[model samples]
Target: MSCDNCETALENLYLFLDEEIDHASIDEIQAHIDSCSSCLTAYDLERVVKALVSRSCAEKAPEPLRERVLYSIRTVQVQITENRGI
Candidate 1:
């Protein structure tokens, strides 16, 4: 991989880790990561970030708070669309 290819590959490293891309692109990105140390470091750091996010988000939601949120979300669907970048 050239520096540019490696850079792009690293930028999409999370998608690669989550297996969210097509097979052909996945193969290309994996191969690029295999040969690029900077990309490897990024991959490692991204994995750590995912782990922390997952671990820290394991708490239970309170029932009243959950109901309130669901009610507000149902009443304000536009806000949901906004948060989703639409």
Candidate 2:
């Protein structure tokens, strides 16, 4: 693969990993990764990092915390509106 292909593949790495791009784009990236060891390694690293972050942030906020946050937001909105005389 040429450096241009590698650069393009790197730019779309996250989209490829997330399957957010079109099928043709996915095939193109996969082909590049299959032919380029460096691209493959980079793709693998990104995949692992994405998985780690997804798992780490899977838990939901506690109900009390959620309520407090909502309350704070409402308070702020009210204050802003009042200040603006809206």
Whole-model Cα lDDT per candidate? 0.63, 0.69
Q: What lDDT score goes with residue 71 in model 2?
A: 67
Question: Distance (Å) between predicted and true CA of 4, model 2?
Answer: 1.9
User: What would the per-residue lDDT of candidate 1 be over residues 1-86, giving only the tens digit for each residue?
Assistant: 23667547855777887888889988898888788665665566566556655665786555675565556534433432333353
Candidate 2's error at 10, in angstroms? 0.4
Worst 10 residues of 1 by lDDT: 75-84
Off by over 4 Å in 1: 59-86
Please give the lDDT score for candidate 1.
0.63
* Clashing residue pairs for model 2: none
User: Could you tell me how far off, in angstroms, the CA of residue 33 lies in candidate 1 after the best superposition?
Assistant: 0.7
Please give the distance, in angstroms, between residue 41's alpha carbon in candidate 1 and its true position after superposition. 0.4
